[model samples]
Every structure is written in C-alpha cells, then in structure tokens.
Target chain A: MQPNGQLSRFGAMKVALHRLAFVVLVAAAFGLMLLGKADTVLVTRLSHAVTDALAPVLEVMSKPAASVGAVMNNIRELAAIREENARLREENQRLLRWQTLARQLQVENQRLRDLANLVPDPRPRSITGRVVADTGGVFARSLLVTVGARDGARKGQVVVAAEGLVGRLTEVGARSSRVLLLTDINSKIPVVMEESRARAILVGDNSNRPELAFLKAKAGVSPGDRIVTSGVTGAFPPGLPVGVVASVDEGHIRVELFIEEGRLELVRILDYGPDGIIADPGPGAAARAGTD
Target chain B: MRPTLWQTLDQTARRLIPFGLSLLLLLLAIVPMTTPGFLRAGPMITLLCVYYWAVHRPDMMGYLGGFSLGLLEDILMNTPLGVSSLILMLTQMVVLTQYRFFVGRPFLITWWALALVALGAILLKALAIALLSGYVVAPGPLIASYVLTLLLYPILAWVFARTQILLTKEP
Candidate 1:
C-alpha cells in the first residue's frame, strides 16, 4: 500500500514538471512578442555571440556544398568558353582604348594634385576577407564575415567590395564579425546628391531598393542622379560611391545600390577607423601631440 | 529470477522513444531554417514534423513541445514573435483530434491527410503574416510551397514509419 502511494506521488510530480515546462515555453513566446523593436545593447551582444558560435559549424557544412557548386560552375563555364573568349577579346580592345584615356587622365590628375596639395596619403593597409555567412535570418540585414578582431577588424570600420560600399562592422568577435548591411532597416546613411549637391538620408527599408527619406523638396533630385556618402555621420568616409537614384515617387525615393547585396563574394574591410582623419593641428607640433 | 534482456530493452524503448523522436524533429527543423529562399515563403518543415509526431505519438510530442519548436523556429528564422508558435500549436491540436482516423490507414491515405494538414497550416501562416504586416501576401508562393511540401510528404512518411518500426520492433 505504501509503495502504491509513493508511485502515485512520483507520477504527480512528473506531471507537475511537464506542466511547468509548458508554462515556461509559453512565457518565452509571449516575452519575445512584447520586446519587439527595443534594440538593447545586451540583445546586440547576444546576437553576435550566437552568430560567432554558429558561424564555424555553418562554414564547415557549407564548404563541401560550395566545392560541388564550383565544380558544376566550372563545367558550365568550359562549355561556354569559346563564345566567352570571343566576347572578352572585343572587350579587351575597348578596355585598351579606355586605358590610354585613363593614363592621360592620371597625368592631368597628378598636375591637379600638385597644384591643390589635396592628396592626404591615406593609410595603405587593409585586410581582405571572404563573406563566409549571410545574414542570419529573414529580418536581420547583417552578415557574418570570416575576419574578426583577431584579423585587425574593429567595430565601426567601413567594409566595401570591389564594386562599392558594403556596410560597417557593428560587432566583432575573435573569429567572426557581424556587418550591418546598407540595406538593413536600421541603417541610415547621410548622402549627397552627386549632381545637385543636396543632402538626404539614405534609409533602408529591409528591401532591395532602400528609400531616400528626409530629402528637402527643393533638393532638386531626379532619377539617374548619383548618390555618395556625405560623411556627416563620420562612420563612412567622404565621397564613397553609394548608389544611383532609381526612382522618385512623390516623397519617397528609391536607390539601386551599387554593390549587389545578394551576390557579395569577397569584401575589403578598411582599416580606416572612425577618427581616421583628425582636424589640422594648426601648424604646431605640441597641438598635434595633444590631439593624437 | 532476473527479467530477460529483451524485456529490459522493451521497457527502455517505451520510456525513451518519445524523447528521441522529438529530438529528430528538432534537427529536421534546422534544415529549412538555414536554407535561403525557404525561410521566406518556403515549405514548412516544422509544421510537417508537428503533424507527423502529433498523430503518431501525441504523448511524447505534446502541445508544449510543438509550441517550443515554433518559438525556436521564430527565433532562428527571425519571424515575428508568436507567429510560428501559434501556427504550430493549432496544427498539433488539429492533428491530435484526427489521429484516430490515421491509426490504421494505408501509406497513401496517410500522405493525403498530411497534404491537407500542410495546406491548412501554410494558409494560416500566410494569412497571419499578411494581416500583421499589412502587405499584400502573394498566393503564388504559398501555393507553390504547399505543393512542394505535399509532394515530399510521401517519402518522409515512409522513412518515419520505417524508423518507428525498426526502433519498436513491433512489425
């Protein structure tokens, strides 16, 4: 009789535990629902930590698949190599003519540079890294690159591709870093209209075409106008190519980004820190020492 | 005299089988979560898992387990909170209620029932997302995803039943 009573008690305890777990799970779901849009610093750190832990496992799994994809791509490329060669030959001739023009422009640029003393001789070091992982999920517009703080990657450093600007490194781990893409909803870049010199906010809407919000009506912006960084925020350098104005619909403007977000292969993380350029020290060595 | 080793094995399997099945379903959820183009308007793998387990082993894969899987998917896929959880809980409840009909059905009939369940789950998910975001949800992707899921269900059901049989040794 005592053993039967004990068995029933144990069963009751087990049922209670199961009910407790259920309550916890439901509470977690409701908690996540309530905490929407509150970007706390702790959450950012947690996201980076989770990405850092998962990136290596993902990288290992993706390599074999990528190798198979590469082999398939090579086979396809071989089949089209003859036609591609003919196209490249014609493109090479056109490029040679452009190269001669580029040489003449370089000579004229040198002359202009000597006259204006405008060359600042930028820091000539950069770490090249491959884009190993894409943005983690549907809503996140960030990427995890292979380079991290161990590879001289620091937070707030601008990351760019061969085409144009990519984004800035927001969080850095020892082995991997998170880059907030320019097309993320939270990203807001101050940009200047290349043609009109008017300033506007390049706002990302988590879509392919980010909108240009907060542009003045008299800014005189039009479609096909070029957009470049205004460097007002100081995170990005001045005069970096951003995108082109694709459409202007009433008050909302959309830009066709220069660097394709989906097809990013390799990127160069600039060593240019936020304080890359200091104000002129006014010709005094002691003043420069204090600023440094 | 001591109980036979076969009896011990049976007892162990009876007690631990549900945990193993739930873990397998959780691992399956990771595949769809990681694959791109699948995250937004792709076949719902977790829903399939919930339906399969809810029908076959409701005692092991309960309402709470389904809800947790949905929550985990929501976090991993970055969907709006409670979206997947709500869908999964409803899917599990529906499957549980209708499980008696599926107990002795042939494999083809089981596949058809799963297709109906998947279609209902996808429609619910699309409708919820559309209402929440206030964007016109495209029905084309939803229908395509549902069809793909339905086509894949037969193969998965076969594998699931084979595993269950092998593990339980009840054939």
Candidate 2:
C-alpha cells in the first residue's frame, strides 16, 4: 500500500495457481530420477551439455566471490602481521638448514646417476584452468573447471593444485570439464606409502579424508607417512604428492589431502600421454622416472 | 483505457521478481561459502524463497517457475536432474495448502512453520543423495544447515517484502 492506500499496478498475485500443473511438475521430477538410471549415457550427455552451456555464466559469477575472498584475506593478513612475522622467522631458520641438506643430497644423487648412466623421464604437458563451480550440498564432490576439449583438456588427465594432486578430469566437454575430486565415492587412486613403499588403493567415501583400501597386512604404515601415486595402474605419474596419512585406527588409514577444496582456485591438468606404462625404451622415453 | 503490449510485459516482469531473486540466491548457494562448517550444508535460500512466494504471492511463482528454478539448480549443482524440481514444487504446494493459516500471521509463526517444512525437506534431500549416490551423509551437517537456513529466513523475507511493496505501489 502506498501513502494514498493505492496498490501497485503490478504487485497483486494474491492467489495460488491451479493444482494440476503442480502435480505434473512433481511427476516430471520423479521421471527425471528414473531416467538417469534407465539411460546413464543420456543423462551424462544432458548434464555435460548443461555444464558446458553454463560455464561462462559461472566464470563471470565466480570473479566477485574471488575478489571478496582476496579483500578479506588482505584484512586478515594485516591483522596478524606480528604473529605471521614471528612464525616466518622461525620457518626461515628451519628452511635454511634443510636447504643445505638438500644441496648435499642433490650432489650425491647426481654423482650416483652419472656413475649408473641413468636416464630421466620427460615432463608431461599441462594446462591450467580456473575452478568455476563445484557440486553443492553433500551429494557430490566434483569441480567444473573452465577448460575443455577445445583447450586440449581431456578425460583422465591428472589435475593438481600448487600443493599436490587434487583429482582427475573425469568428464570433458567442449568448454568445460568435471574434475572428480579425490574425495568422491567413485574415485580410487593407486598410491604408495612413501616411508615403507607399500602399495594400496586410495579410495574416497565422500568424506574430507579418503581412506586407504587393499593395504597389505602389517605394512608398517603409521601416522604422518607420505602417500604418492605409484603409477602402477598406468594412469598417473609416479611420486606425485597426494597426501599424508592422518590416522591408523583398526587397520583403517585415512589421508589428509594436500589441496583444501575451499582454497582451490586454479588447477593444472597434465596429459602424461595416453599410456602411463613405464617401460624400457630409447632416448625419448621409458622407466627412468625421477622426481625433480 | 487499454494498456499497451510493452506495459503488459513490464507488469509480468515485475511480478516475476520473486522467482528471479530466488534463482539468483540459488546460484549464490552453490558458491562455496568461505565460512567454516557451512561449506557442506549450503544456505538453502531457494527453499525459503520459494516458500515466501508460495505463501504471499503464489500467483507469481507458479508451478512452472518453481519447476524451472529447481531444474536449473539441479543442472548447475550436478544433482540428479529433477530432484530439486520435485522438492521445490512439493514445498510450494505444501505452503499453498496452508496459505490461509499463514496469510496474516506474525513473522514468528510463519518462521516456526518454515522450520518444520525445512526439516522435512532436508531429510528428503539426504534420502535423495543416499539413494542416488550411495553415500550416507553425516546427519550433523544436515541438521546444522537446517538451522542456519531457518535463521536466514527473516532477512530474506524482509527483502522480499520491500520488493513486493515496490512492485505493488501505484505507479
């Protein structure tokens, strides 16, 4: 109502519509759920098309959230300058000592390599993309990256963040790809516990910490051990950083992922060739993989 | 006096504000909240937004509008297509059935009713996820989100009220 008690010419929708249409829509929703199971290929195609079509809208929309995050981070950093300075000072001293040790080890490694005439694995090609959207709610843990077949992005490519291996490109479209994060139910990565070199499958159960499956009995695994891809399945490169063992309760070992999904903004998709099979070969390729 | 075609279209667009604003909130829901503990349970803005319209201006956000909004959310959020549509339409229909009771009630009573409806809706969502994805989500996050979404209702309703006034004011 206005000052004169006059209603706006456009605002009086004071009644609900007919009930038949509501019933039809609800039934259609039911049909959609059934359709997914009956025809997964069709459902997958439709979802991909929808994601590809909305990629630009998501890209444009995400910029504002990122800007807000940056601003807030700046304020937070300003507030904790003194504390951060103290922490950095101590970290610098520790890193300086590790730097010396690393140099010595590198020299010894080089000498050994020269003596054995060892070969090194060539680097894989990679493309970086911005994360546009991720599955909402607790239903799924996949990300829509703003790169696709048009940009040379392909399915099965390993996606990594600055810290380490994040996930893999499971679905690729013309303008976007769905990265199935390491925390999804369907994801399983062949990994090795670095301390003991025991192999296992890193399985996700839609939780923050994915668990280790098929681990060898009495494998000497403990808390704080590193986990890396073993490259056994011919899908991922060996020795890529994955995570650290977070716990070992009753033979269940969970890994704390290196990449926090909240902080993940950019991801690099690496094509390690169609075959991850490491074998004896000539000057261009073979089993001489070395971590830099 | 006969209104022109443009005037009629303008009137229709103005009435579509509730649906449009709810769609915008739906998009914002998918944007990962930097806030801890809230990431897993996104703010269920669409639920309350649709409820608000279904109670106050049901003619604007009819079945078609609710269906389209839910379908878009499904497509964008990577849920089984139509799950959201079913949930939203059902929510709207439920609210419409109780329209008379909520028509002139105080904000608190309407909010109290929302808590009940939202709890049911969240449980349904969990069931859908479990059935579709085979992962039983922890109940803690779902309950936490239910409370948070209810807490956010007053603020969203206040904004919708203002917009409704603007839309209905004599031009």
Candidate 3:
C-alpha cells in the first residue's frame, strides 16, 4: 500500500474510534440509569458514599448561602411585621382556647387509660440536624442534613421541622443524610384529613403544594382541611401534621405544606423502632448481644 | 525526560482550573437561594460550563469528564444515576464537533446556538427522568431551567473568557 493511503486509512480508523467512544459513553450512562432502577441498593450505597465524601465541602459552601438567606428573610419579615402581628394575635387567641380543651381531653384520656390498665406505647426519640446542602433542581427535591448514620439518621426516618412534616430520610450516609422532601415528584405520603378522617395519598409534583390522590369517592374533603400522616403503612408515625388543604376544585386537592422550603435550616429526625432505628451503637450492640 | 517540578505544577494547575470551575458551578447550582423562584428556576451553570469548555478546550474536556460531572450532579440532586451524565456527554460531543463553527462566530451566533443546545439538553433530561421513574415528569420546570440557563450564558461566558485569558498567559 502507498504511504499516503496508509495515513488516510489510519485517520479513518481514528475517526471511527472517536465515534465509537462517544457511543460507548452514552451507552454507559444509559446503562447506569437502568442499573440504578433495577438495583436500588447499589445506587443507595453509591449515593451515600458520594454524599459522605462531599458533605464537609457542601457544609462549608452552604454557610454563605444560609447567611444571605437569613438577611433576606429578616428584611421580608420586617416589612410584613405589622400585618403579621395582627394575624398572629388573632391566631394566638384561637389557639389558646384550643389548648385549654386539649389539656382537658388529655387529662381525661390519661385517667381513662389508667382505669383500663393499658400500657402506653413507647415514645419515639428524635435527633436534630442542620441543613448542610440542598439540591433543589427541576428534576428532584432533596436536602443534605449534617447528621447521618453516625448521628442516628437512618433510611425511612421521619424528618420534620417546627412548622410541620418536611420529608423522610432517603439515603443516610456516615456523616450526612439526604432528606427527600415532600415536594419531590417521587414522594408519596399516606395522609388523612383531620376533620373528615378521609384517607388519601399526598403526591408531590416538584411544587410548593402537592396534590391529594386515591381519595375515596365523595370523601367530602374541602379546602382548609388539615392533613396528617395516616401511619397505616408504618413508614411514618400517625398524626404528624403535614399540611392544610389549599384548594379542592374539580376533584383535585392541593395541600399547602406548613413548612416552607426556604426556611428549612434545621430539622428533627425521629427514630420510631428497632428496624434500623438509630440508637447509640454501643447500646444497640449490647441489646443485640443480650437477645443473642 | 521527566517533567521538572515547575512544569508538573503548571500542567496540574491548567487541568485543575476548568475541572475545579466545573465543580464550583455544581456547588453553585445547589446553593440555597432564599429568593422565591430562584430555587425552582436554578440555572444549569454546570451545563453551561461544560458546553463552554468543550468548545474552548476540547482536548481537556471529554466524555469521561462530562460523565463524572453529570454523575456528581445526579448524586447531589438525588436523580437517577446517568441522567445528567448522558445529557452532558452528548452536549460535550455536540459542541466539540461544532467547535470550528463556534470558534470564530459572533457572540450572538454562539449564544443562539447555545440556546438550542440548552433546549435539547433539558428536553433530554426530562425525557430520561420520565422514562426512568415511570412518571410523567412535568415539562414546566424543565422549560424554566432551559430559559434561565440560556439567559445566563453570556454572563458565564464572559467569566469563562476572562479565565481563559488568564490561563493562556505565559509565566
């Protein structure tokens, strides 16, 4: 073969190889997505590993953002203080009345339980974690909390804030945990209306308000109705306040979450039971040893 | 002959600038913006950087770099692995192929091309996510993201251009 022909052939080969590399890279990405869906454990572990390594750096980066947020919030609050004050005053009066009634009912219930000789269920323990990073994107809604597996955070644990239910711990790492917000498209919660006791599923669409689905026909759910976790599936504890029904028009009910995403700085992670409950490792080991 | 210490350091710094900037953009993407609508309409800065570097320094940025960056985004944002990777790699490949066309074009032409690429990238992301999750991922957020990404392209490109100038300066 001629030298120029050899060179041209080599160039063609290089072009083919380049195209092949591009195809291979795309195929590899597609394969990863499919693999992640098929085998969630591998994805979970990988997610945890990556988050754990980057948690410190994310935490540092988030501090400046948090400060900026605080300043903005303060400015907004100051502007709205007058109207907010009046609204809070009215709310405070209404809540005071409810508090009195609730205290009386609680006392009567305890007395009734005592008379019946019933054993009370154990109260769940909770750990507070600071928000270190938030991946608020068009595709997903998740936040990384400073606490993790080492801090007693575990998958399926309930993460809440002062306002209401925030989300669940989806991936817990050694030093960080990812909170899958209730607003994530993939998040679905079994909830019930406080007033009507009608059960439904809260489905997130990456919006501030999630929609209610699987509601019984003519369940009589209406706007302003309170929603709480049903706890029927055991994924979350019962009676955790989730949100209030914002609108119920044409069979579509939107829930206005009590917790705002911007205000999510600190959250509480609740440990309910022995199934992956985050207890001190020492005590947990001792308990297992005792059982054995 | 082996590279001297100064030469090795110079090479390392050159590689780190673009790679490090890519990562910094990722962190910026997730940074908690308190302003309403900011969170929902967060710009795809990493995507922008990927496109820019792929155009400017195709030799340094490739499939592996794009894939790794995308994987980082997926893990950070909790999306299915490879969702961002697939889109990012394709974006890099497309830009690299059209490098000559973009190289000498007016800023407006490059920006226009970037807008189209951004649209495709976002659509690809939404489609991949919907297929993987088996849910009809809404197109609203994706469109918002696309527009925001395109709008921010000029500012980001200016910054990137300055960085390029600094990087190319002789010691």
- Which pairs clash (backbone N, Cα, C closer than 3 Å) in model 2? A8-B168, A8-B169
How well is each residue in A1-292 modelled by candidate 2, as lDDT tens digits? 3743444332333232365677677888888888965758777788788789878877888888888888988999999999999999999999999999999999999999788677665477889999887663555678889999989988888899999998999889899998888987778999998878889999987678999999985458877899999988767878889999999998888999888876778899987665533534566353254332
What is candidate 2's lDDT per residue for B81-168, written digit by digit as tens?
Answer: 7878888888988898877888988889999999999988888987986787667877766776788889889989999999888888
**What 10-residue stretch in candidate 1 chain B is worst by lDDT?**
B26-35
Number of clashes in every candidate structure?
0, 2, 0
Report lDDT (Cα) of residue A133, candidate 3. 71
Clashing pairs in 1: none
In order, the Cα lDDT scores of the candidates are: 0.68, 0.80, 0.82
Report the Cα RMSD per candidate. 6.3, 5.2, 5.5
Evaluated at residue A18, the lDDT of candidate 1 is 61
TM-score list, all predictions: 0.70, 0.86, 0.87
Candidate 1, what DockQ?
0.21
Q: Is candidate 1 or candidate 2 better by TM-score?
A: 2
Ranking by TM-score: 3, 2, 1
Worst 10 residues of 2 chain B by lDDT: B30-39
- Model 3: TM-score, first chain: 0.81
lDDT of 1 by residue, B6-42 (tens): 9888766664555455444443333212344443334
